[model samples]
Target: MILAVDVGGTNIRTALIASHGGTVQELRSRVSLGDRGVSENDLIEKLSALFSEIISSHNDISAIGIGFPGFFSAGSGILLSSPNLPQLHNVDLAGRLSEAVSLPVSMQNDALCAAIGEHRFGAGKGHANLLHITLGTGIGGGLILNGVPYTGESGMAMEFGHLRVAGSDLPRSCGCGGSGCVEAYASATAVSAQYFERSGIQTDAGDIYERACKGDKHAKEIIESAGHCLGMAIAQAIKLLDIHTVTISGGFAGAWPLLHPAIIKSLDTELIPPLKGKTTVLRSTLDDTAGLLGAAALIN
Candidate 1:
């Protein structure tokens, strides 16, 4: 069995997977790193304790795999930087975690892991070329080309969220210090922020989606706008890569009932004549478990 770990800003989720790709056990714990600043040592200690708790009970585990939310030296497993966990910058996370647990460890970007999971076992299965987009607090993307994961030279190939979709006339600011990025409009954070700006009520993306479901015009419009921007970005990508199959997964993807129409409309309007109506966007079947299965696949 391989132990798969998915580390996020708010939680660390772990699971045991069989060699043939089935989940054996799963566990989750709060990161508890509050508003106060976090340190590398604190994060490592927290992860170590969690791994220890699981390892003590599962004697069949052979190796460990991690899906981390950051940029890293793909060959070395040394994290370069993480917008969410900056304290761990330049740390050899895989090496440290391996030492803490005395097991071989492999790591990859969380979104890339999700793509691998989907390509191997989920919606993207059987596709030689696929694009996977995750719409969460921020947007992330992964690509599969000719039956393999492609991370580019710097291990940051598919930074789809940062793609500039808006012109200079109407710039939208993004947390990455850029303007006009698709993520500025299409992320869950963007959805909630847009709703609060127009409604003066602070709520999450899910609640806004529920309001849209109830025929709230303002909420509906906000989500449609997000979907339109997302479609625009996808059109640009498809034009460049000529990949027709796209899979979307994340918390906000549950609102597909509302987002799909706008996305398809935008795609129809934006795509070139020959490429029009050729794209297929699929929802992930593995849901949250994609990342776990992907992490396990790394070591398997």
Candidate 2:
């Protein structure tokens, strides 16, 4: 069995996966160390305790895998920076976790891990080259090129959310401290904010999606705008990588009924002539399990 950890901006989820059959046994979910003013030592101790708790119950665990949200040295597992968790910097998270748990630990970008999970077991199965986009509190992207995960030379290749999709005149502030980024326009957070801005109502993205389904014009417009911006970003990525298959996952993806049409419309309008109808967008079958499965797959 491999212990898989998925560290997100809002939550930390862990699971045990059978190496052969890919069966997953989720342990529990915990609140993540996000903007809580926790120190690096505190973060390590918390993670160690969490792993130890799981290890005590499951003795078959042979290794540990982590899907972390941050910029890291892919080869060394040394985290250089994390936009969400600003406290972690230049830390050897994988090595320290391995020492604490006495098991080999492999770590990579959380979105990239999700891409790997999709490629191996979900909607991306059978696709050698594809793009995986995660639309949650923030937008994230990953790439599979020629049957291999591509993280680029600096391990920061597919920062799709940060892509400049909107013009400077229509600036939308992003969490990454940038304006006019695709993330600022298309993320779940952005969806909620945009709805609130339009209707003077404050609600979560899911509620907004539900409202859209129930024939709320404001909600529909907000979701449609978000989907269009997302499609524009995907178009730019496709132009660069020439990858036609794109898979989307995460909480906001539940609004596919509304997002699909807008995304396809934007793609048709923006994509170059030769690539007009070649793109295929798929919804994830693994849902939230993709990250955990991908993390465990790192062990093999």
Single out the weakest 10-residue window by summed lDDT for candidate 2: 29-38
- TM-score, candidate 1, is 0.94
For candidate 1, write residues 1-300 as lDDT tens digits: 898888866777888898678653776554544432567777677777778888898898898888988887865778887777756668888888889889898988999988988888899999999899998899999998998888888778899999988544868799989899999998999999989989998999999999999998889999999999999999999999989899998898988998988999999988999999888999898878888888888885
Per-candidate TM-scores read 0.94, 0.96
Query: What digit string (tens of lDDT, one per residue) describes model 2 on residues 1-300?
Result: 999899987789998888752677888756565455777888889989889888998899999989998877866778887776777789999999889989899889999999989888899999899799999998898899999888887789799999988544778888777788999988989999999999999999999999999999999998998889988999999888888899999999999999988999999988999989998999998888888888888787
CA RMSD of each candidate after superposition: 1.8, 1.4
Please list all clashing residue pairs in model 1, or write none if there are none: none
What is the TM-score of candidate 2? 0.96
Question: In model 2, which regions exceed 4 Å deviation?
Answer: 34-36
